[model samples]
Target chain A: METVDTLIIVFAVIAVVGSAAGAFLYDPPASPKDFVVTFTEEEHDVASEESGSVSGSTISDTVDVPVPMPNVTALELTVTMSPSNSPPVRANPANAVIIVKDPAGSEVGRKTITWASTESGAKSVDFDIAQQYLAGLPDSVDTRNLTAEEAETWAAGEFTNRTATGIWRVTVQISNPGTVPNEETFAISVSGTATHYHGQARLETGPISGAA
Target chain B: MVKTQAAMGTPEGERGAWSSRTGFILAAVGSAVGLGNIWRFPFSAAEGGGAAFIFIYLVLLLLIGLPIMFAELAIGRKARLNPIGSFRKLTEGNRLWVGAGVLFVGVSLFIISWYSVIAGWVMRYAFGSVVGSYFDDPAGYFTDVQTGMDALGYHIVVMVLTASALAIGVSKGIERVATIMMPILFTLAVFIAVYVGFLSGSGEGYSFMFAPDFSEVDGSTVRSAAGQALFSLSLGQGAILTYASYLDKKESLTTNGTIISIADTGVAILGGLMVLPALAAFGLLTGENAQGGAGALFIGLANAFSNMGIAGYFVGTAFFVSLFFAAFTSAISLLEVSVSFVVDQWNVPRKKAALLMGLIAYSGGIIAAVDGEIMGFMSGSWTDAILILGALLISIFVGYVMKDAIDELDRGGIRGVGRITIAMTRTVVPIILIVLLVLAIKVEIVDQYFASIDLFGW
Candidate 1:
């Protein structure tokens, strides 16, 4: 009986050790492949005429910027209205305006980005621009230069909007610069929304000129 | 001849005196020094207010933990019974008072099921560290090896080892194991602390650990400190009660309790020295995403070992091996609580009681191991809640119910300083513990008040 007890004890120890090994060895299955959106920037020169149209011109311009997206995922494009060259304006109750549309040119989602500051003086604001907002834009949209029509769409979308994909144009018209100085230097920041296959989301942000 | 005869028959009252004073101290210290000292204490310190937490913890240890520990030992020695039996015997066969002992066993068994699983993780990591499996790709290796069947298996191995040791009974088993293991545990802890202290660019980790980030102090920090004081000393659990049952009346409970508390706290501080410095030395402390969970010791230390070159392998192995011993000793105490109860109460043979209790613990442990959430709740929230409640209950029993017997035990001990300390322990300690219990309940309010202050840059 003693020997049997000893043997059982030894077997129990081995079984415990074996199970630990199994736990360490187990791995979850890999996720399935899915389409991903990636952002890239290409610079284009704007004709002088495209820069002058304020509220009704159809001119388009191109701007060069670095791509922030590292992986491919679905895309979301948004347009904001803010003052020219101002410190990045937050979508707040005072001056918050955003418009988003889907690929079929239908409004999908819209919200105001609120500006908040931390004790350390760090500031952040969020706004949503739908994928459909990219539809109905001219074949070539120069983010560097904005026309009156684009500006109106940017403002109107700040309240209402549409959706499209491929190349989308965003225009910013700052209404108030707040306590921050150098309002003209502030450019509208554009970002893309994409969800990777692994359930991680990617976002890209860049400055867009407010020349129009 | 005396040793052999004593071993042959378990004497009801005096059969279990430790072979030496050092054996008792080390055994008690072994119970006190555990994963709580190494991982949990430092995390609490870091989260609570670093240096501020240390100060509060030290105060709590002196004010609350030491007295309750002394009371527990005195009760056990006087009754010459296991926690349940001791309480019943002390209350003159009052059955209701046995709840304190029962609660200790329940909490201990619950703790052992999961604690052994962690011990198994340490065992696996000890081997893996030697092989440099983690050295090649530490993060990926930890993530891969950390969960599932491997963890469960190792937990069971350690649990059975603990149970087998307890089955041999106290003198021949617990005393002998503690004597051999405690020195090794201390040596490794000190060696790691010294080695990590001297590493280049380790100043930050050292400062983070020892320099006291005073900013972390607040009311919640104090409550956590008090809770840790209870845990680090193994106060509320009947382990002390059971261990003290083996003590001869001649032993000084106050002196022993102080020594154990100091040794436990010393090792805990050293463990922080070992972990924080190594982490800081490697600059692995950055990026919030890199912060790990309770398994941080296994994952973090593995990552550190992989980076330490060849020396890292040996040191890492030594650290885990020491941890295995430390954990094994405590695990034995936990298993003994239930097994001893069964043997003492049911009149079952020692070996049979061990097997039954071991089987029950093993099954419960398996369930906990598979479900991380359950394991977490048992170890984290449940253990704290139960320990605090247990400590308060034990205090009331010893302070009021056994006050006269306890006073006589305290008075019979050695000379001048010891006598004064005992008087203070009997009177002052109980009052302070009651206050601590009340303060602990309002800890949330204190935490918010402290958070509003900008001290220590927290």
Candidate 2:
């Protein structure tokens, strides 16, 4: 019977159009194609909690986001540190991140959120604190308008919270003693097309033994 | 009650005839669209060469996947029997393929039993998504939901659902549930995918999934793509053959196969659309934090949704509900594959067959519901071996054992496709399946072989 023909046709059209648009919108194969992956060689520096800086391992987990000029629409860039699978699934965790540049740097769209650690019956499955954090971001990228609590709450927070894509040149420098040699060959690949300031990669200091 | 019904005996047409071509298409597509379309497919696209993988997958489906599907359908239509009876009838009393049908029945039971446990988890997750069960701790939620009597409860519910659909008989039950569920599955997946498209900075995820990053193309990419195409289509398990057995002879198997293939591939690509863009929008797959694995979607989306506040609640509910529907339809087909055999081989009625099999699979479902050693063993090694071996056996039986395969296909108006199907089933598919089998064993059992021994303190 032709009862379901319309349903099939509608989905068929969606399939064709979405796939064709995707196929045409981007051409990655024509470019360099290979992923140039490299890890940061930072010293195992566990900084003091008061200062939030580790043993000089680039001030503990710094993230660099290459950005266009500071005045524009919102953008989001994420940084995660883990061992790569030629195709990765889950990898070992790298503890912390410290985005370089303070108030001046922070002004360029700074809201660092720690990834949520879910708990309790009320927390439920669909709750995503990170998404909420992103949604809470102001339409304007100006950091001066932020309340003190907002600045502190959003400033260099963990990977789970603070949401919405913004223009932040984040630098995450990991100095985990628990990390083995070459556990994670870190790679920094930028998303979004901004022409202004490219979030530069900060060098991590070596251990005393290695430095000697 | 079912036993009494079985003793009375019903007519064959009720057990066999599809209500219409549309009904048949719905059922076949139902069998194909599953958790793989939602959970596995997106992760796979991102892992392989993204768009390049898509390109290779389509090619393989056409040159490889579709022909075999046609051949399987042709076999069923020609013989008009369950897998065992059909193979036996086609081969004219040759015992070589008798095991394939039996193995298919076994594999179907094994797969469905294990699948129910997972489907139950998806269902619970759907409920939890709305009610905020894991909002406090997603990892803790996964840990809690993955095992124990709570999981068993969900498993039982899923098995009962599967039985109910089957109990209603083929036309009213299987056809109706499938026709309703498959459309919802497509609509929900597309709905989420379109929403993701409007995300402000989602180009990265889209590119990562569909941009054809050819440099990532390698043996693993091709192997994974080929393997996915084979498994995602629900081949090798005789589900297709069983569904086809119920088809009207007038329906063209080739056209049906093409439509099913398109729908399956479309859902899968759309799944990628749903996931990859959302992750990119949330900043999940930056090469830095690209925790590329099965959990990436769960973790990233959990973060994204949790951050979305109230809107995330509705969106999350929609996604999980869609997943549950997808899992439900596939579970029905898996149950039917085995139930079909019981009806044909024995004098059992359809309802009785569904009940008896449902109860049996339900027992295994309990064990699979556990998140411990026993559950892992059955779901991991036991099921994978059975499925791979089933596929290998089907390919070999059709190619080398069944002499009238060409004629069987020719009976369905398919000419050159028979030769191609035989060639792939005999040669290419079997060899690749072997590799997949070995790799699975190496990863699941052998790699852990030593650890398991230590675990038991033997």
Candidate 3:
């Protein structure tokens, strides 16, 4: 009987220890690291191109010049054209043709902007292209006035390959078609930033220049 | 097989007998329904798989948990000893088989030590709710009371109370207390559940709880449900074994186990209804730390109460009181196991055993409660490790070494449906327990598997 009692006592001790050990096996440590991330937004500037003065005279005098602008990295550009609010009546293409050129004079990216009227009583157009194509463009030749045929050729180039940025030009021809005061050609530079995953470039234009 | 009529002596003049079948069931249910039901179950369900987890947990409780509970009870009754001596007798005095019972008692004591600390927190919260101290800053109130000397003081107070109950012996003290407390617990839970149901926009909370999200069903969820089922049933620990020792031979062990398991599972389900819906109604169900640890329940309920205004205070007090009762009853069982060891083995008087056990538990609990890190380690890592290993040993002893006696004890008294349950309890249940015991040891898999569930907003 004493042996039995001694055995029971031993068993009780073992039982307590065994249960503690078993429970420890199931309870693991909690993680100490935090694995959450947060993001915030910041402000920046937009890129644009500058056109030089049109020095030619007479109805047939035509000058082909490239606009100057900063190098854009990865950006989608859009351009729109409508009769200027302060303009004499002018007949022109309702859409603006956008062309991007690399420093090596190769066509990299291009798009056409269509005019749409918003509730603010303003007609505007826009185009979207990858910022990478704009980043390769030359610093000079931001905007130019193009003839109808040139716009068609630019459209073909837009579909084929990207334009390099050495000398890029956009041309807008204004014709007095309606019974209104006549005016010379009008030039406007579309401005925006070229943004990429790595960074972005800000481009600004000089003032708009015109030709008669 | 040599059958010996071994009279494992109790302390002189001590009558530690269960009064009736009702007494045994109520006491067992008291041990079974605890923080595991209110504090653990809803959070587990929310973290496991919402409604799908509830479904799987219920099935596992009925299938795996119920039968094992019956087997544990039957073994205890047959041996008529504490867990340590029961296994020894079941194995016809094989010393190795006694390891399972020893492990169980150790785990129970460890659990009792820290469990008292938590019970103290409940008591403190109960008081705070009455005085409106929690309303000012509920979260801060919980943090302040849950750590440091205040927690230690309450833990000692609760531990002493539990020891006192056990010292009065089983039938008159533990059973009688449970008889009164269990109904109040159930009634309080049901009342809270119904009251929460009437609150506006409670329908959404109900839908979230009852509506099954089939997408969440996976192997990890199933395993967690299984673990919760076993834990909530109070299996493997000698609580049931100790309770069963007082049971009369004429009682149908199978029938009693089924009834107790059903009652325990019912309380757990009602507890989920009480908590989860309230959490949903209050929109406190989201957040990374929303469903981990005991703090989750306090935080969630406090948030719910603050939103509900003055009525929240009365309801909160009632809830914590019920929680206190549930925890108090379970703690009594834990201390009783230690007392039984002293009385059965050393012929120590019940009162003396209770005093010794109480002192030891109080000291351990004070160490835990004063140091937050120690309390976490005791409750988290220590409890899990001991329980899993102890359960494994118990499963092996019941399934393999003492199969004959287990079968014999399962056969007598139970009839009709009870007899069928006995057959399943003897064979199928033991096999499932063995499998779970093995799976629980693959610690990496279990941890990674449970971690992968996106339930805690992870």
Candidate 4:
């Protein structure tokens, strides 16, 4: 209704037209290139087996796990164990160690687990393999803004011994067999980011006995 | 029934007024309905107990949002000036009240600066939809797009767009754009909701949205609902007040405010329909995957979009385009508050004010884009605290300090609700806002600050 309103409205319309003209007149920045980076989640499980007679004080076995992706964002290993077959054995007080190696046979992750002697029945422990490896690296970088190439390099350095695209080896061992022969049944579950793999871990080596 | 009131008369000295009631409603509604209505509301409802959250949100909207909305419109229309000028006039030059007005401008700047950064991400997503940039690895794409030089570029683009609108003036720039964009936003929202409704597994999402499990309700749920009610309506920051300043007194703030609230809430419900159904269809509505907030919308919904084959492109584009429209309009309103402050308080020309404020806000957002911590602080709990404080101060001013709010509320077609509304504003609104203010401080500010510092190793 006022003179200022009418003039400003006219000016605004002109501005809008000018902006539209500018947008069309000048070339806009190109959109980022389309990238395909699919991440997959898979779990690998090893069947339950009894910790048989220990030649020394440890029982060891290895499982093969397939990782078909080049970049691994996360990896975890979970173990559940209980006293096997022996009805009278209420507690399994043994220490468990897990070691994972890439296709190149270099150790990438290792974790040791132990249970209290008084603990009874089934117990479980989860080890974040990727997190452990990542944590061990120097905390000098903020991963949020890393370029894809930089992220790749950073990831590669942390997981130099942990390739994601191969049949990896995982070794599980039980030690501290004590005089009673603990006789524990354990299952190991491994999970990580990969693509297009049969998500399972198969036993590659037996329950081998080792001298203390 | 909606006749112009001759007694109040048009304020000749006012900068501008909406061309019509419909234009005013559209601009106001455009300000109210934004990303909060889309992504925030559904997640908040789901996390706060679905239907239960909606119920509390509606209640609080009536108790908290509506009164504040009415008060702001009343103050703006009464004084017919920018926020600071309005308070300066209404309070008869009370320095304390004028500073509250200044706080509104400051909060608006803070809100727009960080908001433009986020809206820039939406703009990128909208563009990316055309080329399928984020289709393959939506999660990774989100992380990349939200930071680095790319984010800053988009943020600047958003600020430039908003500044252009403001430089044009109220009726031509904001009202005109909102008139065109609001309908488009509503249509796209409806189209997506109806499209998602036809999906086979969408019933799970509908149930998750509609089925009220009150068992999940808690104090935090109430607090969230209250916060959402305030945030969704764009109350407490003088955007509504500034918009209302450009409104002719013949238009009823009551009817207009109610319509804006209902429209905003409707869009929020529609947003839930679109997002939840799509998530359910993709089997992502439950368990750890059913995360709330930005991650769920950008990453989880992007994953769903990727799985939809060729159709996903069109749908995702429409969705993000609508999101951009919503964010763009709100950004315009927010930037207007500061621009209007500069123009009215400092005697600056409208074009210069818009550019100056826009440039300042844009500079603020550059840091927000590169460093997310500053963005989080500016846009997150601190913003919430300031908004709550603003609303509390407005309620006190309108109901107690200002003598003529009831007269302004009584102006135009609607009448007779002023006494009761004023009574509630004086009594219930302040009490509710006080509670919300304390809750906002405790939950959003103090708790978050302590948590960030890892106080007590929490």
Candidate 5:
């Protein structure tokens, strides 16, 4: 019994000491961090009528930016209206999946992108890559320059840590109305990086209403 | 108090006293520490600027939580009955007083109903940790487990555990289990905090939890902090009062209340250290990528453990197991309230009373588990409302109605009682609680209800 009491006392000391050490020695990120990623927009415009539901999504075209999606901590994607009068966009398929394809049209890796918006009139949503996307990412994929094209892959097979990195024909899908204009400009930029406009947004309808 | 004490008549030797002071402390501490510590407190801290909110909670715990606890303990020790019986015994002829007692028991039962459902979730997570089921996808796993038959199945498991502990009777059951399990629970909480402290990136979590920004202090923050302080200590529902009723006269209510409050608060702060660091390290804060639900957001944090490599499985399992112990101990206390009620009032045997109350609470748990709308109403709005109302009434009864209440506070001349306790509970705490109750209802019920109405455009 005395032994048990002593053990508890020792454990209690460790808990207090350890917590105190953490409290004093460890400091949080004192300031809020803002991420910047440049998006090179691809073709994306899948109509809900063709997709059969307001929640349907299809890949337009993938953007190649300086910092891959994994590197940026968070991103706020804003939709610009063609008429400049579209209601604030309501994004569906709340989780957008970005698939990495090799130059040969072979698949390498994929990451799911999550975003949050208002109940209505939400023209933009912030996607926290570190929290939502990267936590589930395979260690095989390098987080730094996570989506740099295949040329960056280690040479001579002398790689200490290797992951399939090059992505070709990435699929960036979005659903819900007013999120995309007929000829919307997809802007891609990394946090703390210069904001730059990318290619024309082209929406592709997937498996249509009669999709198999 | 004097009239009822004589008229209601006293039954000597009807109930067993706690075998030792340690036993009493453990039982009260066990009841106070549970999901409130793990589930709500950290989330409140996160919402209220981490350290700043914890500061408010501690202040309230001292001013509001401690005084009310002492108030309840004094009443129960003197009356030496279940909450309903204690009230009936204290104010023998007053139906309103008896009604207040009924409300006390009802609130305990109500809280356990939803509480058991969440405990069931903890059980499932603990089980999943061993099999590596969520190794790849924590979000997908929790979403699947949180609804339908999955939730009900686990609620039943917890309900059975609660009944079994209580059926064995108070001393052999509550006192014995509390003595053995409380140490284990405390050790688990501390060791988990220690592990968090050692983790490389966990410093951010500690910073978020322990260091107050002070800028985030606001009305909603106060509401959340105060409700949590009272709720974590099991103040409103008579759990502490019930446990104290089992204490010997030689025991100092003030000293015992302080010990229970300190132990309860220590475990709660430790829970933040255990959980928040991991959540921050994994980047699992509020975002699209974050898990939904106000109080039950730890699922997002628990989901991150699988990503921690081989150590994740062991840590995840141990965390959930400790969670189960925490939940189970508290469930036993809540169950004991209704069980004790039947035993005292209906003259039912302990075993039968345990089973009956357990089954009754199971039906309520089913409602809480199956319907999200109902669960939110009861757990968030109703629980606070009942608890705050219960606290108000208990204070008024003791401070205003009960005769010689000040003299009662002076019992044993324990450290923190007497004129100040009466002024705090009788006057200050109840008034503060009323304002808090109004704010909590607006935030919890009206805001959510209005949001849903807007969502549906009704």
Candidate 6:
């Protein structure tokens, strides 16, 4: 009985002490971390199918850019559209709008470019989103006045540990279709790179029907 | 303290004794492992404090759950009767003690009344998986069938199945079913756990289940851990006691009790390993996507399976079928507690008692199935209160009041430590149960319910 009593006391003490030690010493699961994630640049080409009477018509294509897909700190989209005609046309103005949406279906960035069409090989427009966000800061809110952490947060802008991480959609819509003497063919290629944090486990979603 | 004079061997009035020690252990294990393990444990651990919650829960199970389990078994084997009969016989027909027995039996009946309804839901899920009925929209399917006439129909189906097993008698029915189903349940659970481990991002499930974040621990966490230990073990309900009553005296209570405890806990851990990882892989483990209780299992996991294409069909079928076996075994034990009482108290045959009690429980289940709120209310704080109160009183009865209870515990190859167990039961067991009981009422009922009404306008 005495041995049993002593054993019981020892066991109870161990349980109590072990629990307190574990409570204080135990480490939590790691939080989603912030890191610069780079995406390999890829060009996707889309051709306009319309030939004659191409005015008032639009041609558009959406592409999926593969990146670490969340908390994007830096992104650059370069759109190059080249149009060719049997007889070259002059001053055929065309408007191009580039749209980017995150996995949550929230539109995060948009850029518009307009140019006069010529028989040139290619016309290029560049959208550097991070610089745009940095430039968008309020005039009165000076970066020098901010604390180090605050400045870092401000620099990260809308990309600080954003939870939306799966798929990113980039769509380019070209309007005011070509006015060539005979027929016109426009080839547009959209390419970009994105930097984001890498920590959270990527979602393993199955391919959806009709998704490219 | 009047000692019970019933013989140490098998008593005359037992419904039926377990044919072998293995059958008894398997049946006891079956009773302990149920929907609580599969549906509730993973989420509870996730919500409580992950591994910290598991640690506290294991401590409570060792210190408190096991002792009470031993006491219940000892009392049952010694008296060799139903809870009411056992109490009356042990206490020399003391009315107050006899009423305690009635409460134990009543708690079993109360639990089963709604328990069968949920068991019915498991059945529907099992069948639904085979037919691929819920694959299209899991959440919508659960909502459509979880209540009303559909729930009632499944509820009746579950009740009839449970009653049929009971009516077949104990050794042939309950033991036979447990012997066969327990192994199958283990195999299916292990198979799923292994299969899901190969999936990408499943490591998050491991972290979610096992990473200890002590900051989440609080008063409610401790209370929840303690309550879960008792609830998961199926202690404080007459089911354990009732099952013990049919045991042969030569079988060691300590050995059987220990095995049952370990087996039950193992099944719960396996369930966590299986479900949590699969949920993480499919990106369904997020707070926004994952729900609590049955919704976590039925809706979230169901949706994950639907996305898995052809493979989901086989795995989903295996998962729900194992769950059905687990639920069915437990529902049988719950029904048996009342059936045993009727058989012993009224000199009724086992078949008739099972039928009568089954019909009554079936009717109560219909009401639960129809309303759903009734099921919630019955399974909530009030049930916790009853279960805790019963355990507290039994500990007191065995430790201080009942004569030769330690002697009974020492029987059947248990040589020593009976006195130590009784001492702990008298002191630490009651104290812990009292704390848990108060916390159960304060947190579950008062805090949840009265806060809404604001009766005192505080």
Per-residue lDDT tens digits for candidate 2, residues A100-119, read: 33213443333332222121
Give stretches of model 1 more than 4 Å off.
A1-212, B1-15, B144-146, B213-215, B287-293, B403-412, B415-458
Query: TM-score, chain A, per candidate?
Result: 0.30, 0.28, 0.31, 0.49, 0.29, 0.57
Candidate 1 reaches a DockQ of 0.06
Question: Model 5: runs farther than 4 Å from truth?
Answer: A1-212, B1-14, B286-298, B413-416, B450-458
By descending DockQ, how would the candidates be arranged? 1, 4, 5, 2, 6, 3
DockQ (C-alpha) of model 4? Answer: 0.05
lDDT string for model 4 (B228-269, tens) is 888888989999999998888778888888899899899999
TM-scores of the models, in the given order?
0.66, 0.66, 0.66, 0.74, 0.68, 0.69
Interface RMSD list for the candidates? 13.2, 20.3, 24.8, 15.5, 19.2, 18.6
Chain A TM-score, structure 4: 0.49
TM-score of 4: 0.74
Superior by DockQ: candidate 1 or candidate 2: 1
Backbone clash pairs for candidate 4 read A56-A210, A56-A211, A56-A212
DockQ of each: 0.06, 0.02, 0.01, 0.05, 0.03, 0.02
DockQ-derived CAPRI band for the predicted complex in model 4: incorrect
- lDDT tens per residue, model 6, A59-161: 7778775442334555676766666553346346667677876655667678776656653466777777665545656676654576533443444433332
How many clashes in each structure? 49, 58, 64, 3, 22, 1
What is the DockQ of the complex in model 2?
0.02
Which ten residues in a row are the worst by lDDT in model 6 chain B?
B2-11
CA lDDT, every prediction?
A: 0.61, 0.61, 0.61, 0.72, 0.63, 0.74
Consecutive 10-residue window with the lowest summed lDDT within model 2 chain B:
B1-10
Better of 1 and 6 by DockQ: 1
Pairs with steric clashes in candidate 6: A37-A196
Q: Write the per-residue lDDT of candidate 2 for residues B287-383, one digit (tens) a residue.
A: 3224333244444565556655676777777787887888888899899888777777665667777777777677656655653344556655435
Runs in model 2 deviating more than 4 A are A1-212, B1-10, B286-294, B381-385, B410-415, B423-458
What TM-score does prediction 5 earn? Answer: 0.68
Question: Which of 3 and 4 is ahead in lDDT?
Answer: 4
Tens-digit lDDT track of model 1 for A18-87: 4564456433222223343434332222222223323222222232222221121234543332233223
